[model samples]
Target: MSPSHRYEIEGCEVIWAIKDDSIGNTFFDRGAAEFFLPHLTAGKCEENKPLKRLKYTVTESSSDSPKKGDTAMGGALGPDWKDGWRMKGKHDQAAHRVQVEYQCEVQEVLTREEFTRTGQTAECFPGTSRAEEQNDDWPVYVLLTNKRLYGCDFVVSATGVVPSTGPFLHNDQFSVAPDGGLRVDDHMHTSVPDVYAAGDVCTASWEPAPQWFQMRLWSQARQMGSYAAKCMVADRDGEDIDMDFCFELFAHVTKFFNYKIVLLGRYNAQGLGKDYELLLRCTKGLEYVKVVLQAGRMQGAVLIGDTDLEETFENLIVNGMDLSPYGEDLLDPNIDIEDYFD
Candidate 1:
């Protein structure tokens, strides 16, 4: 019988199954790896390579199942684990929590079918609290789950600014198009004019010959969101807004667990950057990284394994910086290479 889900002990930021690649390692000691992400990312960033696609080869390892009587700590990984992360000197506990949860959920799903299908049963008693008969000295403990006491004078719905439905939690977004070229929007806005949306929820239209421009992405989102917010505020205040700025959305790139992943602009934008050549290089591991360029300008990057270069890569992409400065240094692993700025 096949189980609905399976669990494992591993830590990974990006799990690309199509490429048979799983960037980042999960199901490992959290404490040990907490110190590895930065150094690893930095090492890869120093390489400055890029990839349009890639694959991963996963190796499975066994983990002991919890004992019959072991108590579930809900979400906390116990005091020792929590303290270990805190002692590491990183302020971000949410990252550690997310990685741990992913592993635990994977494991729990694997074991669920067995426990539920074996005709097992859970028993609980119905309790009656008699108001008058209760002892007067006992203290009552009340746990609030759905209390809505936190009131906000102004409500900002950051749910999303794009037309697409939701977050890119498990997989990327997919949608079909009219021409039927298999439009892979990735996350571009669906419309324009009176409204503009960016980030992972829009499909932008930009044409070199047509001489028009529109794009979607995190950086674009920040700019567009600011513009939109200002527009709204301006309209409310009866002020004329510029609204002349154009959005040049680029792909989002980052490193995690050691995997380098880049999501270039709408995948369906065919012939968009087709003529622009990009260079890529990598060594095999649990994580991989890639860098992209166009006409000598560093356009974007996808990094895993090492991400220390994220800031530099992002700067170059945003500023459309000339990549010729560090072309030679990118491939050299031992060149004390921060001089690209000079």
Candidate 2:
């Protein structure tokens, strides 16, 4: 029987089906956060690039020398951030306890009736917490997918975004990026003369800095619009304009889940690929600081909570200084990073 009220749910098991696209890796690791998040992501990426709107990195490295490090330790700071980020415990329980997932695609979401009609009975419980207390007394619906069924109750949709290019999709007179953002030059000029576009509707067609790339974000949109105006003014007077310094390296400051977030450069080691390494340090409650290093140069970072390191990190990224010499001391949570760099 289909569910009616809370009491009416006793006989029928209602389950939200989430199909995981990660193959042969086991089903539990698929879309674990999306399955739990109350809000789904609403962002688009460049075509073939396929960027995710949000991702989490864990800080699990304390290597005194060098190693492939985790990127999440930069966010755990809690109370002592203003006082030079003086965090207490170095390792809070365990550093790598969090299971961070990304690029998890939900192939489909099927209703209970559809699941039954299709006759999928894959009993995969990767989504179930290992700490789950057995509640066999509570009858639940039979859950299954092309991947496997999850122990957690609730439906998950993995469609992050499809760009709304609108009427511009069919116009051949102007160039378009694969994501349908109007192709814009460094000066924010469209292919057609006298035409200008910026913000979410535009994409960068020029070569970008090593640690810089475009993403659909509030800060970027504001920066783009402002720069486009300047470029327009410069063009009207026939004056040449240099690309804004803001495009030199990525810098984003905002709040997420009540914590102040500062992302600089390739915060998540985006395009660095296998050659990059991460340095992470954190206290459980206070802050998380993650630094990305490629061949000993600062490439990017993710800073969470209130540990004040944005200015120093931003300069380091812009300067492209080699930091392989510092090793572990680079991310010491107790040190005055700004003072040292100064």
Candidate 3:
């Protein structure tokens, strides 16, 4: 069930089948504010403001960092980003508490029944485990895993979307990707000419642009849907249509750990390996900025906080302009980087 419907659904009892009762680590994409914020709020209005002001601590240092330093401690602030710093600080404090309380582990999920009847039952009183509470008369079913057994009545599958193509793939009419998504061409058309697939249900079949690849994100889904419509119309009219420009570069704006995060192109140096160089500027608790450069040209960037550098970086990446002359001065705090671009 989505976090939005957690409180709205009535009559049917909602049970969370989770490994632990800790509030953090409920979301898979730590950078997704939509997912992360809801879990933190948990259908509470009062928690919303505080959640926005929470400062996210950078626990692990990035491989590209010069020295192991806390990215959330002190950092240069962009204009109107004092709030960003405050929020990150608060989030860091809260995150520290959660870290101390909950040590997360990755484990395979099992059905509630499969877990309960595993022949390893440990009887314990209520409130001992963070799992659901049953009637005093009814014994709580404790499901055991390699890490720990969680006590709960019903298990909620909040894990994520799993591609299930077994039923459709059984038919000989379609070709499916190894990942189980329907293989689709640049036009978003599937193997069957008349049939087309888009969004999470389809795998990109065309040679992707250097800066763009498929991700199962809402933004990509929207782009695919719109582009697929145009492709379908062009096919109906027997007109050729070029692929949409949105696929030329990857762009995503989100909030992670209470800071505005903008990921552009190969933000993590995706397929570039060690062939690229990274220039980073971090203000502890203020902001973190990372730019990926390849062959002296800007290829990608990760902008945290309200850095107001997205347009400049995006242009630099799309245009493939050489910034080697500027060197590290491209990220120099004293320079008006945007003005330089102008």
Candidate 4:
């Protein structure tokens, strides 16, 4: 979670002030320090490679929804997840459903005067105008679902981001992806020669490995930035550049919910639709391992805890060897899978 996307009301005490707050994965949970700066940013950040520094334009969005000045923000920047979890689709979705949801930024903050009074408020709060009741200087929040307004003390928004493709759009100089990022080839070159882009501002236009896809995450940003620099040097020196192995497969390592987690390939079965098979082994709070297989070939695996399967599973995915004969025994806890394969 970038501090850039986190916004808070002055002296806000809503989530903790109440009980049963089931907002979208409440990343900076009730009573937790707003960052709660997201552990994702701590260890997984890109190294300070020897490259020229690029500047970014930081802007805050202040749009408003009419029903309530309140809205939960999410977009290009993506969602703020728990203390960890580097990249992912949305949360609390049904197994049959895969969703990527982006909530609009809080359109506007409501002042006591700008707030609307509705009978629902009277029935809900019983005779007290919520707007009139909140601190005069603080912004008011409303939970709006389907145009119906519910009174709320405050809301925590995990803002999304769209690539800022500045003046390049003026003359149509660079190809832009639907997500509003500059499209770059394997070398991270824009359609316009000699121009390169990296980080959240550019999109990978090449055909990615089947087990790999892109998400706007710090880890990816680091990889792309470093790779782009190398490509620049290679081009300047008239040398050939090969696509970095980092782009060959999707992988992330982090600790979330107190478990050491290692993600490999299409760990969530993303883009596989319903054509994949899933096998999961979990031991309450201690461990969770999920593997995605297609036609008996390993495509991805999510290994939580120190399950010691990362190396073997990674080899399994990259080598693309057949594991059909092992059947369920592939994950049999009683059997030593590594030795079986060795």
Candidate with the greatest TM-score versus the true structure: 4
Candidate 3, residue 178: CA error in Å? 1.7
Please estimate how well model 2 matches the true structure, expressed as its whole-model Cα lDDT: 0.60
lDDT of 4 at 260: 52
Tell me how candidate 4 scores on lDDT: 0.61
Which candidate number would show the highest lDDT if scored against the true structure? Answer: 3
Arranged by lDDT with the best first, the candidates are 3, 4, 2, 1
Q: Model 4: per-residue lDDT, tens digit, 111-137?
A: 444565432331133234556454333
- Write model 3 residue lDDT over 1-342, tens digit each, in one string: 343333222223333333444332332223332234333323222223443322434455545755655453542221224333332221222221111113333344445456556765544332334264333222344333434554434444546544565666767788888888999999998887688888878899899988888877666777898899999999999999999999999987655444567889988788898899988887765667888899999988888778999999999999999899999999999999899887
lDDT by residue (tens digit), candidate 1, 1-342: 000010111121211111111213321122223433344213222223444433233443333875666653332121122212321212232221111112211112113334345443321111213352222221211111221111111211212133443443233333423322113222222332233344334443333222123433344555555565666566568787554334343444533333444443222223446755445444545434355556677555545445355565555656666777667467455653345553
Question: Would you estimate the TM-scores of all the predictions?
Answer: 0.36, 0.59, 0.63, 0.64
Q: How many backbone clashes can be found in candidate 1?
A: 31
Q: Give the candidates in order of TM-score, highest first.
A: 4, 3, 2, 1
Name the runs in model 4 displaced over 4 angstroms.
1-109, 116-139, 146-154
Query: Which wins on TM-score, candidate 1 or candidate 4?
Result: 4
- In model 1, the Cα lDDT at residue 120 comes to 36
Model 4 / residue 129 / CA error / Å: 17
Off by over 4 Å in 3: 1-97, 100-146, 149-160
| Per-residue lDDT over 1-342 for candidate 2, one digit per residue giving the tens place of the 0 to 100 score | 100111112221224332233311221122222222321211111123333444335665667765565453543222222223221223322111112133343454555555556654534333544454333222233333334443334443423234456767566778888887889989999898899988778889999988789977657877898899999999999999899999999888754333456888888778777998878876654667778899899998877678888999999988988898899899886778799999
Task: Output the lDDT of residue 336, model 3.
Answer: 92
